[model samples]
Target: MFPIRDHNPSGRVPYVTYALLAVNIAVFVVSWFGLRSEYALAEFYYTWGLVPAWLMQGEGYSTLISHMFLHGGWMHLAGNMLFLWIFGDNLEDVLGHLRYFLFYLACGLAAAALQVAGDPGFDGPLIGASGAIAGVLGGYLVLFPRARVDVLLIFIIFFRVFSIPAWVVLGIWFAVQSFNGYSATADGVAYLAHVGGFIAGAVLVLPVLLRRGFWVQNKGKPPHPAAEYLFSPSRIPRVPKR
Candidate 1:
């Protein structure tokens, strides 16, 4: 299951989030079209993507940030952008655009750190925005635990959209990441990076919430214009017009 959208509409246009989407797509296109050869693509990833061994050798330090803008393929890019589109605007709303951008960078750095810590000797290049996007998921869970999200569920041939609380969605996600980080032996995916970025986002959003008085004054308060979240997905039956 994955989320396609959220019911809590952002109060403002998320310029930073859209800008990020543009950059990531543009980079992927360039990597695919300009590089032209598998060897060249691999070389580009080695130089720009986060490689734990390179980092340990006191080089490629910039990959921590640059890596967040790179992706391995179309599905990878689409997935990350979808998450960013759904959740990023909310955090941007709460924190303002500039601070949200910094928060994203900090989370990406934390994610890269944890991925390297998991296997400092691994040489393969790690490329994707998933780690940083996981951080956004973390922050979204904390601030809008009760908000409704539109999750697209796929089970073999069946497909459906389930509208559920953010906590349920993010909680299940965190559990999967943790399980993979600790137990699964998947080679390409950086599970630990996901786990670390999520934790970082949750931790980083706290001070902002406290400073803004949301922690005290609006504790447990939900989205305004409550009607916006009243309906789930399109699959659910709508009321008949009078």
Candidate 2:
């Protein structure tokens, strides 16, 4: 099941979230158009994307941060943006824009580090916003466990949509990522980065959550009308203007 939307919304405009979305798209467009050939594009990614061996060799250390903005392809960019669109604003709402921005960066860095640790010698270049988006998913679960997320499921053209709690959705996601992480075949998905980013988000958000007394609301609550933030047309049915 894939999350299409969530009922919980941000309390204010998520400027940083919007900015990140714009920047990611912009970077991809520039990289896609500027390169003349496939080989050239690959070289670009290798230069900007995080290569664990290169990093461990005391070289190209900047890729840890840059790689998060560089996606491998259109679907990769779309999937990551969709997750960010669904979950990021709420975390930004909870953490405020600046802290949320830093939180995202930290998660990405931790993701790269963990992936490097998992296979320190892997030569392939890792690139995507997924690791950072995974962190947003983790933070969302901690901050809004009870919020209803509408998931779109498809199996052999049998399409279905349903609403479930954030915890359940994120739990399944984490389980799948963890399972794939230990699997025998490497599909080049960077499961370790996903796992690390998710954990980092939860750990980093804990203190802030406690300080803000959100721990008291640990049970989570249903979304209220006032909290509905519309960055775009929500997948959930919108109430008509009276």
Candidate 3:
């Protein structure tokens, strides 16, 4: 299933989110088209992408930040950007632009650290904004647990769009990442990075949530009433007049 959009709307434009997206795209274009050859691309990734083994040796430390802007392929970039677009604006609205940007980078750095901790010897170049984008999802869950999101479910040839609470979708995603990280032996994907980024985002947002009186003022609040803005199930089926 893929999330298409959220029913909850932000009160302000998310400049930081848009800027991040632009940077990621620009970097990808430079790497793909501006670089002289495939070898140059590989070299660029090696220098910037998060490599656990290299980082453990006290080298390439900047990759913690740089890797967040690098992506391995088009689909990888598109997926990460989609998630960010869906969930980031609301967060930026709540946290303000600067704090949100810092929070994002902190989560990315923490994610890389966790990945390194999970596999200190791996040399594979880790590339993608998934870890950072996962961070945004984490914060969104905390701030808008009851917000409705439209998800497109794909089953074989069957497809459907449904509205569900943000908590349900994000919670399931986090659980899956943790389960996969623990169960997998080989390190093809950075499942640990996803888990780490999520944890970081959640933890980092706790102070902000508390200060905003989220728990006190909105305790046990149901999904924001605005969720109805997207779609609501029909109470009565259409009847034909003859």
Specify the highest-TM-score model's number: 1
Q: Residue 200 in model 3: shift from native, Å?
A: 0.6
Put down candidate 3 lDDT per residue, 1-242, tens digits, no spaces. Answer: 98988887777889999999999999998898888888989999998888889888988878888899998879888989999999998889888999999999988988887888988998978988888888888888887887778898999998878888889999999998999999974647799999999988988889988887875675524324464543444446789999
Q: Provide TM-scores for the models.
A: 0.91, 0.91, 0.90
Off by over 4 Å in 1: 215-222, 226-242
For model 2, what is the alpha-carbon lDDT of residue 99? 97
Error of 2 at 71 (Å): 0.7
Name the lDDT value of residue 23 in candidate 3.
97
- CA lDDT of every candidate: 0.86, 0.87, 0.85
Candidate 3: the clashing residue pairs are none
Residue 23 error for model 2, in Å?
0.8
User: Deviation in angstroms for 192 in model 1?
Assistant: 0.3
